[model samples]
Target: MTRSLPLLAALLALVATTPLHAEGDPESGQRVFNQCRACHVIENDGRNGVGPNLHGVVGRRAASIGTFRYSANMRELGEQGLVWTEDNLRAYLANPKAVVPRGSMAFPGLRNPAQVEDVIAFLKSRAG
Candidate 1:
Protein backbone atom coordinates (compact mmCIF):
# COMPACT_ATOMS: atom_id res chain seq x y z
CA MET A 1 0.00 0.00 0.00
CA THR A 2 2.88 2.40 0.78
CA ARG A 3 4.44 1.67 -2.64
CA SER A 4 1.07 2.28 -4.29
CA LEU A 5 0.80 5.58 -2.48
CA PRO A 6 4.10 6.80 -3.89
CA LEU A 7 3.12 5.77 -7.40
CA LEU A 8 -0.20 7.55 -7.09
CA ALA A 9 1.52 10.69 -5.90
CA ALA A 10 3.95 10.60 -8.81
CA LEU A 11 1.10 10.11 -11.26
CA LEU A 12 -0.78 13.02 -9.79
CA ALA A 13 2.32 15.17 -9.96
CA LEU A 14 2.77 14.41 -13.65
CA VAL A 15 -0.83 15.22 -14.39
CA ALA A 16 -0.60 18.46 -12.45
CA THR A 17 2.42 19.55 -14.43
CA THR A 18 1.02 18.63 -17.81
CA PRO A 19 -0.08 21.59 -19.91
CA LEU A 20 -3.84 21.87 -20.34
CA HIS A 21 -3.60 22.16 -24.14
CA ALA A 22 -1.75 18.88 -24.56
CA GLU A 23 -4.59 17.30 -26.54
CA GLY A 24 -5.46 20.17 -28.87
CA ASP A 25 -6.98 19.06 -32.17
CA PRO A 26 -4.95 20.10 -35.19
CA GLU A 27 -7.90 20.04 -37.64
CA SER A 28 -9.94 22.23 -35.34
CA GLY A 29 -6.87 24.37 -34.92
CA GLN A 30 -6.58 24.85 -38.66
CA ARG A 31 -10.16 26.03 -38.80
CA VAL A 32 -9.65 28.37 -35.89
CA PHE A 33 -6.45 29.61 -37.52
CA ASN A 34 -8.63 31.41 -40.04
CA GLN A 35 -9.07 34.08 -37.43
CA CYS A 36 -5.34 34.65 -37.43
CA ARG A 37 -4.96 34.66 -41.24
CA ALA A 38 -5.39 38.39 -41.44
CA CYS A 39 -1.95 38.91 -39.92
CA HIS A 40 -0.09 35.59 -39.82
CA VAL A 41 0.74 32.83 -42.28
CA ILE A 42 1.60 29.16 -41.71
CA GLU A 43 2.51 27.79 -45.15
CA ASN A 44 6.07 26.64 -45.77
CA ASP A 45 6.51 29.32 -48.42
CA GLY A 46 4.32 31.78 -46.58
CA ARG A 47 5.49 35.35 -46.53
CA ASN A 48 5.29 37.81 -43.69
CA GLY A 49 1.87 39.38 -43.66
CA VAL A 50 1.13 42.12 -41.14
CA GLY A 51 2.77 39.74 -38.68
CA PRO A 52 5.83 37.51 -39.14
CA ASN A 53 5.60 34.20 -40.95
CA LEU A 54 4.73 31.47 -38.45
CA HIS A 55 6.37 28.64 -40.39
CA GLY A 56 8.47 27.43 -37.47
CA VAL A 57 7.13 29.55 -34.70
CA VAL A 58 6.44 26.82 -32.16
CA GLY A 59 10.07 26.24 -31.18
CA ARG A 60 11.34 29.69 -32.07
CA ARG A 61 12.36 32.58 -29.91
CA ALA A 62 10.08 35.54 -29.72
CA ALA A 63 10.72 38.25 -32.33
CA SER A 64 13.44 36.18 -33.99
CA ILE A 65 12.24 36.72 -37.54
CA GLY A 66 14.64 39.13 -39.19
CA THR A 67 12.43 40.74 -41.79
CA PHE A 68 9.44 41.45 -39.60
CA ARG A 69 9.59 44.36 -37.24
CA TYR A 70 8.69 43.43 -33.68
CA SER A 71 7.63 45.58 -30.83
CA ALA A 72 10.38 46.43 -28.34
CA ASN A 73 8.63 44.27 -25.77
CA MET A 74 8.81 41.14 -27.91
CA ARG A 75 12.38 41.78 -29.00
CA GLU A 76 13.42 42.25 -25.45
CA LEU A 77 11.70 39.05 -24.42
CA GLY A 78 13.52 37.23 -27.22
CA GLU A 79 16.81 38.71 -26.08
CA GLN A 80 15.92 37.50 -22.61
CA GLY A 81 15.50 33.97 -23.98
CA LEU A 82 11.78 33.50 -24.43
CA VAL A 83 11.27 30.36 -26.48
CA TRP A 84 7.82 29.49 -27.79
CA THR A 85 7.10 26.39 -25.72
CA GLU A 86 3.50 25.15 -25.39
CA ASP A 87 3.08 26.76 -21.98
CA ASN A 88 4.37 30.10 -23.18
CA LEU A 89 2.32 29.92 -26.37
CA ARG A 90 -0.77 29.05 -24.36
CA ALA A 91 -0.32 32.07 -22.16
CA TYR A 92 0.40 34.36 -25.10
CA LEU A 93 -2.57 33.03 -27.03
CA ALA A 94 -4.75 33.65 -24.00
CA ASN A 95 -3.43 37.18 -23.59
CA PRO A 96 -0.65 38.63 -25.73
CA LYS A 97 0.00 41.56 -23.48
CA ALA A 98 0.13 39.30 -20.44
CA VAL A 99 3.18 37.55 -21.82
CA VAL A 100 4.73 40.59 -23.44
CA PRO A 101 3.63 43.39 -21.20
CA ARG A 102 4.50 46.13 -23.66
CA GLY A 103 3.58 44.11 -26.73
CA SER A 104 1.98 45.56 -29.85
CA MET A 105 -0.39 42.78 -30.86
CA ALA A 106 -3.63 44.57 -31.67
CA PHE A 107 -5.75 41.44 -31.54
CA PRO A 108 -7.32 41.28 -28.11
CA GLY A 109 -6.95 37.54 -27.55
CA LEU A 110 -8.91 34.29 -27.62
CA ARG A 111 -11.45 33.99 -24.86
CA ASN A 112 -12.20 30.32 -25.36
CA PRO A 113 -9.44 28.17 -23.88
CA ALA A 114 -10.20 25.47 -26.42
CA GLN A 115 -9.74 27.90 -29.29
CA VAL A 116 -6.37 28.94 -27.91
CA GLU A 117 -5.29 25.32 -27.61
CA ASP A 118 -6.51 24.60 -31.14
CA VAL A 119 -4.49 27.49 -32.51
CA ILE A 120 -1.39 26.23 -30.76
CA ALA A 121 -1.92 22.78 -32.22
CA PHE A 122 -2.31 24.29 -35.68
CA LEU A 123 0.90 26.23 -35.31
CA LYS A 124 2.70 23.13 -34.13
CA SER A 125 1.36 21.15 -37.08
CA ARG A 126 2.70 23.77 -39.46
CA ALA A 127 6.04 23.56 -37.67
CA GLY A 128 6.52 20.20 -39.33
Candidate 2:
Protein backbone atom coordinates (compact mmCIF):
# COMPACT_ATOMS: atom_id res chain seq x y z
CA MET A 1 0.00 0.00 0.00
CA THR A 2 2.87 2.37 0.74
CA ARG A 3 4.57 1.74 -2.58
CA SER A 4 1.21 1.89 -4.36
CA LEU A 5 0.64 5.36 -2.98
CA PRO A 6 3.89 6.62 -4.56
CA LEU A 7 3.02 5.00 -7.88
CA LEU A 8 -0.43 6.57 -7.86
CA ALA A 9 1.06 9.97 -7.14
CA ALA A 10 3.49 9.63 -10.04
CA LEU A 11 0.75 8.58 -12.40
CA LEU A 12 -1.40 11.53 -11.36
CA ALA A 13 1.47 13.92 -11.93
CA LEU A 14 2.10 12.46 -15.37
CA VAL A 15 -1.56 12.79 -16.25
CA ALA A 16 -1.59 16.37 -15.09
CA THR A 17 1.32 17.36 -17.31
CA THR A 18 0.24 15.36 -20.35
CA PRO A 19 0.08 17.45 -23.51
CA LEU A 20 -3.23 18.54 -24.96
CA HIS A 21 -1.57 17.60 -28.25
CA ALA A 22 -1.42 13.94 -27.32
CA GLU A 23 -4.22 13.59 -29.85
CA GLY A 24 -3.40 16.77 -31.77
CA ASP A 25 -3.89 17.02 -35.51
CA PRO A 26 -0.51 16.33 -37.06
CA GLU A 27 -1.72 17.01 -40.61
CA SER A 28 -2.94 20.45 -39.64
CA GLY A 29 0.35 21.08 -37.93
CA GLN A 30 2.19 19.90 -41.04
CA ARG A 31 0.35 22.49 -43.08
CA VAL A 32 1.25 25.16 -40.56
CA PHE A 33 4.87 24.06 -40.55
CA ASN A 34 4.90 24.72 -44.28
CA GLN A 35 5.21 28.39 -43.47
CA CYS A 36 8.38 27.54 -41.62
CA ARG A 37 9.60 25.33 -44.46
CA ALA A 38 10.66 28.43 -46.31
CA CYS A 39 13.13 29.18 -43.53
CA HIS A 40 13.57 25.83 -41.85
CA VAL A 41 13.51 22.13 -42.57
CA ILE A 42 12.23 19.57 -40.10
CA GLU A 43 13.67 16.48 -41.68
CA ASN A 44 16.57 14.40 -40.42
CA ASP A 45 18.56 14.90 -43.60
CA GLY A 46 21.08 17.19 -41.89
CA ARG A 47 20.12 20.07 -44.14
CA ASN A 48 20.98 23.48 -42.73
CA GLY A 49 19.37 26.30 -44.60
CA VAL A 50 18.49 29.81 -43.43
CA GLY A 51 17.43 28.36 -40.11
CA PRO A 52 18.52 25.05 -38.66
CA ASN A 53 16.82 21.81 -39.58
CA LEU A 54 14.32 20.99 -36.87
CA HIS A 55 14.25 17.23 -37.37
CA GLY A 56 14.20 16.50 -33.68
CA VAL A 57 13.73 19.86 -32.07
CA VAL A 58 11.28 18.94 -29.38
CA GLY A 59 13.09 17.80 -26.24
CA ARG A 60 16.32 19.07 -27.78
CA ARG A 61 18.46 21.76 -26.24
CA ALA A 62 18.04 25.22 -27.75
CA ALA A 63 20.54 26.47 -30.35
CA SER A 64 22.22 23.07 -30.60
CA ILE A 65 21.59 22.87 -34.29
CA GLY A 66 24.95 21.63 -35.46
CA THR A 67 27.00 23.71 -37.88
CA PHE A 68 24.42 26.45 -37.75
CA ARG A 69 25.72 29.74 -36.49
CA TYR A 70 23.24 30.79 -33.85
CA SER A 71 22.94 34.28 -32.45
CA ALA A 72 24.92 34.78 -29.27
CA ASN A 73 21.65 35.16 -27.37
CA MET A 74 20.39 31.81 -28.58
CA ARG A 75 23.72 30.18 -27.78
CA GLU A 76 23.39 31.51 -24.28
CA LEU A 77 19.94 29.92 -24.00
CA GLY A 78 21.40 26.59 -25.09
CA GLU A 79 24.05 26.86 -22.43
CA GLN A 80 21.30 27.71 -19.94
CA GLY A 81 19.57 24.30 -20.36
CA LEU A 82 16.56 25.48 -22.34
CA VAL A 83 14.86 22.49 -23.86
CA TRP A 84 12.15 22.78 -26.52
CA THR A 85 8.84 21.77 -25.08
CA GLU A 86 5.34 22.58 -26.37
CA ASP A 87 4.65 25.45 -23.98
CA ASN A 88 7.99 27.03 -24.66
CA LEU A 89 7.51 26.56 -28.38
CA ARG A 90 4.11 28.24 -28.23
CA ALA A 91 5.51 31.20 -26.41
CA TYR A 92 8.48 31.41 -28.71
CA LEU A 93 6.31 31.08 -31.77
CA ALA A 94 3.98 33.80 -30.55
CA ASN A 95 6.91 36.19 -30.42
CA PRO A 96 10.51 35.19 -31.02
CA LYS A 97 12.03 38.41 -29.71
CA ALA A 98 9.73 38.39 -26.72
CA VAL A 99 10.96 34.97 -25.72
CA VAL A 100 14.59 35.67 -26.50
CA PRO A 101 15.47 39.27 -27.05
CA ARG A 102 18.19 39.78 -29.67
CA GLY A 103 17.73 36.19 -30.80
CA SER A 104 18.38 35.61 -34.48
CA MET A 105 15.04 34.19 -35.56
CA ALA A 106 14.08 36.97 -37.93
CA PHE A 107 10.78 35.50 -38.97
CA PRO A 108 7.70 37.00 -37.43
CA GLY A 109 5.96 34.55 -35.14
CA LEU A 110 2.61 32.89 -35.70
CA ARG A 111 -0.08 35.03 -34.16
CA ASN A 112 -2.95 32.57 -34.00
CA PRO A 113 -3.07 30.28 -31.03
CA ALA A 114 -4.52 27.46 -33.08
CA GLN A 115 -1.71 27.75 -35.57
CA VAL A 116 0.87 27.65 -32.84
CA GLU A 117 -0.81 24.57 -31.41
CA ASP A 118 -0.79 22.96 -34.82
CA VAL A 119 2.91 23.71 -35.27
CA ILE A 120 3.64 22.07 -31.95
CA ALA A 121 1.60 19.07 -33.08
CA PHE A 122 3.74 18.80 -36.19
CA LEU A 123 6.98 19.08 -34.28
CA LYS A 124 5.84 16.41 -31.84
CA SER A 125 4.77 14.15 -34.68
CA ARG A 126 8.26 14.35 -36.14
CA ALA A 127 9.96 13.77 -32.82
CA GLY A 128 11.85 10.49 -32.93
Candidate 3:
Protein backbone atom coordinates (compact mmCIF):
# COMPACT_ATOMS: atom_id res chain seq x y z
CA MET A 1 0.00 0.00 0.00
CA THR A 2 2.85 2.40 0.82
CA ARG A 3 4.41 1.91 -2.61
CA SER A 4 1.26 3.31 -4.27
CA LEU A 5 1.09 6.50 -2.19
CA PRO A 6 3.21 8.63 -4.54
CA LEU A 7 1.23 7.51 -7.60
CA LEU A 8 -2.06 8.22 -5.85
CA ALA A 9 -0.84 11.66 -4.80
CA ALA A 10 0.20 12.51 -8.32
CA LEU A 11 -3.13 11.36 -9.73
CA LEU A 12 -5.01 13.47 -7.23
CA ALA A 13 -2.89 16.51 -8.09
CA LEU A 14 -3.58 16.09 -11.80
CA VAL A 15 -7.29 15.73 -11.21
CA ALA A 16 -7.34 18.82 -9.03
CA THR A 17 -5.62 20.95 -11.68
CA THR A 18 -7.74 19.80 -14.63
CA PRO A 19 -10.80 21.89 -15.34
CA LEU A 20 -14.12 20.15 -15.92
CA HIS A 21 -15.08 22.94 -18.30
CA ALA A 22 -12.75 25.39 -20.01
CA GLU A 23 -12.98 29.02 -18.93
CA GLY A 24 -14.96 30.88 -21.62
CA ASP A 25 -13.27 33.24 -24.07
CA PRO A 26 -15.60 36.02 -25.17
CA GLU A 27 -13.53 36.82 -28.24
CA SER A 28 -13.73 33.28 -29.47
CA GLY A 29 -17.38 33.36 -28.62
CA GLN A 30 -17.84 36.37 -30.88
CA ARG A 31 -16.65 34.30 -33.80
CA VAL A 32 -18.97 31.53 -32.72
CA PHE A 33 -21.80 34.04 -32.71
CA ASN A 34 -21.50 34.30 -36.48
CA GLN A 35 -23.22 30.96 -36.70
CA CYS A 36 -26.18 32.45 -34.87
CA ARG A 37 -26.46 35.75 -36.71
CA ALA A 38 -28.66 34.37 -39.44
CA CYS A 39 -31.34 33.75 -36.87
CA HIS A 40 -30.52 35.96 -33.90
CA VAL A 41 -28.79 39.23 -33.07
CA ILE A 42 -27.11 40.28 -29.82
CA GLU A 43 -26.39 44.00 -30.10
CA ASN A 44 -28.37 46.54 -28.18
CA ASP A 45 -30.92 48.09 -30.56
CA GLY A 46 -30.41 45.14 -32.84
CA ARG A 47 -33.53 44.21 -34.74
CA ASN A 48 -35.14 40.86 -34.34
CA GLY A 49 -34.18 38.40 -37.04
CA VAL A 50 -35.75 35.02 -37.71
CA GLY A 51 -35.36 34.78 -33.97
CA PRO A 52 -35.59 37.51 -31.36
CA ASN A 53 -32.76 39.94 -30.68
CA LEU A 54 -30.78 38.53 -27.80
CA HIS A 55 -29.39 41.76 -26.40
CA GLY A 56 -29.95 41.00 -22.74
CA VAL A 57 -30.62 37.30 -22.70
CA VAL A 58 -28.36 36.14 -19.89
CA GLY A 59 -30.80 36.60 -17.07
CA ARG A 60 -33.95 37.04 -19.10
CA ARG A 61 -36.77 34.59 -18.79
CA ALA A 62 -37.19 32.08 -21.57
CA ALA A 63 -39.50 33.32 -24.34
CA SER A 64 -39.77 36.74 -22.78
CA ILE A 65 -39.06 38.81 -25.90
CA GLY A 66 -42.45 40.22 -26.67
CA THR A 67 -41.84 41.06 -30.30
CA PHE A 68 -40.90 37.54 -31.23
CA ARG A 69 -43.36 34.70 -31.14
CA TYR A 70 -42.44 31.79 -28.96
CA SER A 71 -43.57 28.20 -29.23
CA ALA A 72 -45.94 26.80 -26.66
CA ASN A 73 -43.24 24.73 -25.04
CA MET A 74 -40.95 27.73 -24.60
CA ARG A 75 -43.73 29.87 -23.24
CA GLU A 76 -44.68 27.14 -20.85
CA LEU A 77 -41.12 26.87 -19.65
CA GLY A 78 -40.96 30.60 -19.07
CA GLU A 79 -44.32 30.60 -17.31
CA GLN A 80 -42.88 27.94 -15.06
CA GLY A 81 -40.12 30.35 -14.02
CA LEU A 82 -37.28 29.24 -16.26
CA VAL A 83 -34.63 31.92 -16.22
CA TRP A 84 -31.64 31.97 -18.51
CA THR A 85 -28.94 31.45 -15.94
CA GLU A 86 -25.48 30.39 -17.16
CA ASP A 87 -25.95 26.83 -16.01
CA ASN A 88 -29.37 26.74 -17.64
CA LEU A 89 -27.94 28.20 -20.83
CA ARG A 90 -25.23 25.58 -20.83
CA ALA A 91 -27.74 22.78 -20.66
CA TYR A 92 -30.10 24.40 -23.13
CA LEU A 93 -27.38 25.15 -25.67
CA ALA A 94 -26.18 21.59 -25.46
CA ASN A 95 -29.67 20.41 -26.39
CA PRO A 96 -32.40 22.98 -26.91
CA LYS A 97 -34.97 20.40 -27.83
CA ALA A 98 -34.20 18.49 -24.70
CA VAL A 99 -34.59 21.64 -22.65
CA VAL A 100 -37.81 22.77 -24.35
CA PRO A 101 -39.35 19.92 -26.18
CA ARG A 102 -41.28 20.98 -29.29
CA GLY A 103 -39.73 24.42 -29.25
CA SER A 104 -39.22 26.26 -32.54
CA MET A 105 -35.45 26.64 -32.46
CA ALA A 106 -34.45 24.65 -35.54
CA PHE A 107 -30.70 24.60 -35.27
CA PRO A 108 -29.01 21.59 -33.82
CA GLY A 109 -27.33 22.20 -30.47
CA LEU A 110 -23.64 23.02 -29.88
CA ARG A 111 -21.78 19.83 -29.09
CA ASN A 112 -18.49 21.25 -27.91
CA PRO A 113 -18.49 22.11 -24.23
CA ALA A 114 -15.75 24.75 -24.59
CA GLN A 115 -17.61 26.51 -27.38
CA VAL A 116 -20.77 26.49 -25.32
CA GLU A 117 -18.91 28.07 -22.42
CA ASP A 118 -17.42 30.70 -24.68
CA VAL A 119 -20.82 31.53 -26.19
CA ILE A 120 -22.33 31.83 -22.75
CA ALA A 121 -19.48 34.12 -21.75
CA PHE A 122 -20.07 36.31 -24.77
CA LEU A 123 -23.77 36.49 -24.05
CA LYS A 124 -23.09 37.43 -20.44
CA SER A 125 -20.68 40.13 -21.57
CA ARG A 126 -23.35 41.56 -23.85
CA ALA A 127 -26.23 41.09 -21.45
CA GLY A 128 -26.19 44.78 -20.57
Worst lDDT 10-window in candidate 1? 17-26
**Tens digits of lDDT, candidate 1, 61-83:** 98998899999989999999999
Lowest lDDT block of 10, candidate 3 = 19-28
**RMSD to the hidden true structure, all candidates:** 3.7, 6.7, 1.8
Name the lDDT of candidate 1. 0.89
Per residue, candidate 2 scores C-alpha lDDT tens digits across 1-128 of: 89799999999999899975545577998998888888898877768888899988888899987799989999998999988887788889989998889987888899888888888888988877
Off by over 4 Å in 3: 13-20
Q: Model 2 Cα RMSD, Å?
A: 6.7
Q: Model 1, residue 16: displacement in angstroms?
A: 6.5
Clashing pairs in 1: none
Clashing pairs in model 3, backbone N/Cα/C closer than 3 A: none
Sort order, TM-score high to low: 3, 1, 2
- What local distance difference test score does each model get? 0.89, 0.86, 0.90
Measured by C-alpha RMSD in angstroms, how accurate is candidate 3? 1.8
Among these predicted structures, which one has the highest TM-score?
3
Off by over 4 Å in 2: 1-23
Judged by whole-model lDDT over C-alpha atoms, candidate 2 comes out at 0.86
